[model samples]
Target: MSPKSLCFTVLVAVFSVLASRVVINPTPQVLKYVVDFGLTISSSPSIVAMFIPFDFDDLRRHHKNPDKGKPVSVCEDFPPNFPPPETNTTLTLCVDRNGCCNFTTVQAAVDAVPNLSIKRTVIWINSGIYYEKVIVPKTKPNITFQGQGYTSTAIAWNDTALSANGTFFSGSVQVFSTNFIAKNISFMNVAPIPHPGDVGAQAVAIRIAGDQAAFWGCGFFGAQDTLHDDRGRHYFKDCYIQGSIDFIFGNGKSLYEGCQLLSMANPVAPGSKSINGAVTAHGRASADENSGFAFVNCSVGGTGRIWLGRAWRPFSRVVFALTSMTDIIAPEGWNDFNDPTRDQSIFYGEYNCTGAGANMSGRAAYVQRLNDTQASVFLNTSYIDGDQWLLSYDT
Candidate 1:
């Protein structure tokens, strides 16, 4: 008999006996599937089958209640007994425009806290879109912004570099405090998407200049400069960020773990040479600055042809370790932004990255394929000084 017929017979006989025990094991971990040949028998196999491990528990839970959103975990930045009932020790302020909370606007709720207070304060925002520019000044420490969920709670605004505020100051939410934490929230910039013809459209969703800050389950959306990790040491986990040009640009020492970096298409212009934009523009100006961006095990994909990064400053530094990139990434993974001199200074590298886009064969000459030892430096939390703060919060 033919190989295809033999395999089909074998599968039928195997499944027929296994089906008898289905009542005992309702959900099996193994998933079996068959593949058909597309080419000639010599070039391609007539029958190929494989078994994959499927997560039945998660699948069942999701099917049970698809509408229910994931619950927000308690802030790791604060202690278990943090925010005590005492006004001096703790405060929980709610902001709901529909009269379900203390204040209607987010700023009002934030302003209610005492400046330079040592106590922990949690601002719980209800599900709604608040179109306002929110700022957490340097004075406020140990403050947490808790939202209903990323899709349910959003702080959005429209401001571009061409606006009166300028690129550096045009942020929907700007945080300059220390020991701050945000969870299940979204920071959005409603500025128009950038086009090749556009001149300077750098809008920021969130400008985080805070030290020892952590964001979890958050979303940042914009076109250019979506997230400005400007100055400080920070950590981001399970977050989604989408943009077109130099989206996640900054000088902060940051560790992005298990996050998503999505690319959007750039509008076509009369004389545009490239249709896609660069994902990062790290600004580590000098070698002395202890700042860089490390993305570990992150998912990088989306529309448009894009580069992993471009040198925003002379000593720009960035790394991607064990990340999964899509075909959208350009073969020349890193760009010098037409500045040949920057090619000598950028510390761009990748380690054990997988995917068609992660291939280093066609990458720029300056881009380094890190070895096991070199990759270890950027893969851990220590890259962002997280050893000092992250452990404390996590405990």
Candidate 2:
């Protein structure tokens, strides 16, 4: 071969080797900035593109590696909100406005009980309007309140945001005790109906503060703040929940099976907002998190019109599975709670939901339709698992 051709061939071989090294070893800058920020690197011309930058510290704080070998318990950690359980005692406080058990007040009966214990106790409330604010704390569990009738045995209070210091979301009938149950009762908050432009008032009717609490055939009536399924895991079966605004809003993971959600007109919105206001604002804070509210086989329709729900928090996750919705449900199905930015992170979904409102044609792109396997995770009852606990309640 000629000397010039040989020299050119050697130069081409060196260039190929250099190119191979560059492709194999990414630059230090790329490693430090691009890979650490979850960027993808392409090799045609060596390009780095960031899809989603994940913050490892934030992830570590939010999620920990699961201890797979840890034994699961029937009852997890208890909150400080429940009252001590009552045992071996049956206390009947019949507060009839004018009849037998003539105590006119419900608070008097609650006060009459001595320190609660870890035993079974029943407080039979008669048919009357007991105007009082009642609270059952974490120390008091296993307390059953049986009412004479769903509508006749009424506990009415009208505590509004103006009456207290907290916001509408804070109005709650918190139940923290375990194994607490209420049957055939009505919890109503008769707060003054909001005037034509008042937007910032809340009157909470019932708040379940206890854990392992169940309500059967109960009625929760109010314009807003109707049933504060505030915290813990609650089971409400065959119950009626009525509200106007974001009535059912909280962080508790509750299951409402075979219940009725009634909607009243928003006094402020008038003609613009329709009647049945938002149904729920579940306060879950993470995507892979377990805290949320689920409505199974429930019917969502009321006398008035309203949106099905809106995001109460940025990462709020709620699911309506196999439920029947009415025409009153808005086409959008879910709202961003008046803020458009929250739509990016919220997980509002429906599986096998049927009704005029369940149509997904108008749903936002962020709303998801979970597949069968993903949906099964929500049914598991070891906390989020589908244990036999949900079956224990008699709806």
Candidate 3:
């Protein structure tokens, strides 16, 4: 069979099984809607179908059936008799707001896990918007937040630096525990983007102050201080991060692989002509800090003129290798954080990067155009000691 037909057949088979467990507003019209939608699923077939949100009215108008109405029970799809094994070392707790599974809130589920447990615990968050400030404290470890999909599951908040707590404490989702993994989730800070006279508008979508943490197929969205990769050895792969000012800043010895860094339009400050933003502000205070930002096989694009990075601390280090940059990047890329003295210690470099902004002619004199020998050091998993913690989730 053709690939499209094969995909449809598989989806039909999968959803047919799911339909047995789920009553999809059960009516002949609804049943016909299933058949029509199932055939349309060929384009983006996902075998993992569950309680996917569907518009009942939209379906009913398109097809007619004589079956009477009844209250739909989402729990039927997840029977208690088939509860997850109790002794299963690799536990997965489902978080459904409508009391369909184990817990209703994400924090409640996180609180249930034992601290410092050796076994990996997976918190499977359903497709919905969770408005909460989540934190995985230092005492907890080996935890994974698995979302349905990047666009489908989101955690959002509106905290800012001006809050009773400072910017350092203003993360919508802060992870301090080691060996944490977040997949297919979007972390958002809904606070207004900083503007002129906007005091303490450093809203952070997510903060990683943990070691051996990894993010895959995730998204971070905000305007200023979008992602605080605060401190640790971390890895971000196939993720999307969008912001305007110092969006991807931190002191973490981390690697961003195949990720997208989007720069929003400039937020003009008072009396400023053509205001712009910087993508990163690495804060490596000393040479012994063992922290830097590595962008490997990543892409930088979006609106507004911006600098690739600025040194938040004297010894800050950052490298962009085999990445793509758009003309949005400032010709003189790396900034010295308005401190000329930082020019002497900061290590900002790029290697084999292609795009309109990759021209070395106008790049800052201090920014290195690394040769193969130097580029090798920052282009692999070794940059974040991934050999030790990233083996299990190598995708």
Candidate 4:
């Protein structure tokens, strides 16, 4: 183990001892919508998770089914599962709405971090809805947004494509710096939901243009273009993403494991669904772009007849492995965006997936028939070079 890992292991042992002595009694009101964890390190979900991610089933055991409901006003404070900095001199910023911490707004706390600092700066956000558009600039790298819980803490805005000047800038939470980490927080674009064929209604909950970004137990909410996984390598584990048309779109080389992809597509009669929505719209312009989306052991469910993904760009690439899909998916598993030429280049495939929607009888022709060897390349964190920056965890 690296020195950092050795220190974290020691800290975990010490913290476990201290945690066993405490008693937790959350208020009744806060327990109803859990559908999850107190989250990381009291106020550092992203930090604790990266260093000590548990088993997938352990992560899934407490989660409520996405179709059942979302989290309401529920969150509980706790001791750090693993606090960083053996010394009290380490850098950490606290954001609380009532001014109980270093700052009130998330952006202000982000601005407080030193630019070009090699050490990671964590911003602990208290449980509350922050109505603001936050950005992590390129100059400041290694910033982490650790929240109380996915259901209790949120950053919200209502910028539509036209309102924000462009769809790319409409995200409520935008990350442009490298090595960004967010855990247990929900990013929401609360603009009005749009019709299936509507235009200018693209509202992005989060736009991650940063390299080496990782999100754990997070939430993303919107109607269209919900998550702009813009560019770079990202890992999202056990996240809840809700949206309609092209809900999860972008060019990022991302791996989404143990995630719940809840589709918010309208519930219409099967035959009446003419202008329907799609779950993903990967925009890989060239075969050599080195960007695509790989979803492993995820769950896809919700209303509307949705396409697994469409060839948003000519050379778009995507894969779903060991995932469970509902009948909400269109019979034709994928679309070529009405471009016959794209059918020659796009790579859309599924392997070992289950559920009615996973049936391949009506799938598009261009889908790659992936074998075990080919599927292994995109099966784990290795696809995104995660070992370099991410904490080494058994999961």
User: Largest lDDT belongs to which candidate?
Assistant: 4
**Residue 84 miss distance in model 3 (angstroms):** 2.5
267: Cα error in model 4, Å: 0.5
lDDT of 3: 0.76
lDDT score of residue 227 within candidate 4: 97
Residue-level lDDT of model 2, residues 1-395, one tens digit each, is 64324333333333333333443222111111111111122321121111111122322222333466454331233123323343355444445443334255655555554456655556667554455677766666677777755544667655677666654423434455766788878776655545324555577877776567778877777766677777777877778777767778888877777777766653334345443478887777777656788787788865455666778888887888888887777667788877878888887878888988788888767778877776665543443333554435432
Q: Residue 110, candidate 1: how far off, in angstroms?
A: 1.2
| lDDT score at residue 18, model 2, on the 0-100 scale | 37
TM-score of each: 0.76, 0.68, 0.80, 0.78
TM-score between candidate 2 and the true structure: 0.68
Q: For model 1, name the residue pairs that clash.
A: none
Residues 189-237, candidate 1: write the lDDT tens digits.
7655666447767789899998989998888878788899998999998
Candidate 4: 10-residue stretch with minimal lDDT: 28-37
Please tell me which model should have the higher TM-score, number 2 or number 3.
3
Give the distance in Å from residue 330's predicted Cα in candidate 4 to where it truly belongs: 0.7
Question: How many pairs in model 3 have backbone atoms within 3 A of each other, for residues 3 or more apart or on separate chains, i.e. clashes?
Answer: 0
Off by over 4 Å in 4: 1-90, 270-275, 392-395
Per-residue C-alpha lDDT of model 3 across residues 20-100, encoded as one tens digit per residue: 555655221122111223333445322221122222332233233336555445554444653366564676778876577
Ranking by lDDT: 4, 3, 1, 2
List runs of model 1 lying over 4 Å from the truth: 1-84, 87-89, 266-275, 391-395
Each prediction's RMSD over C-alphas, in Å, is: 15.5, 28.2, 12.3, 12.9
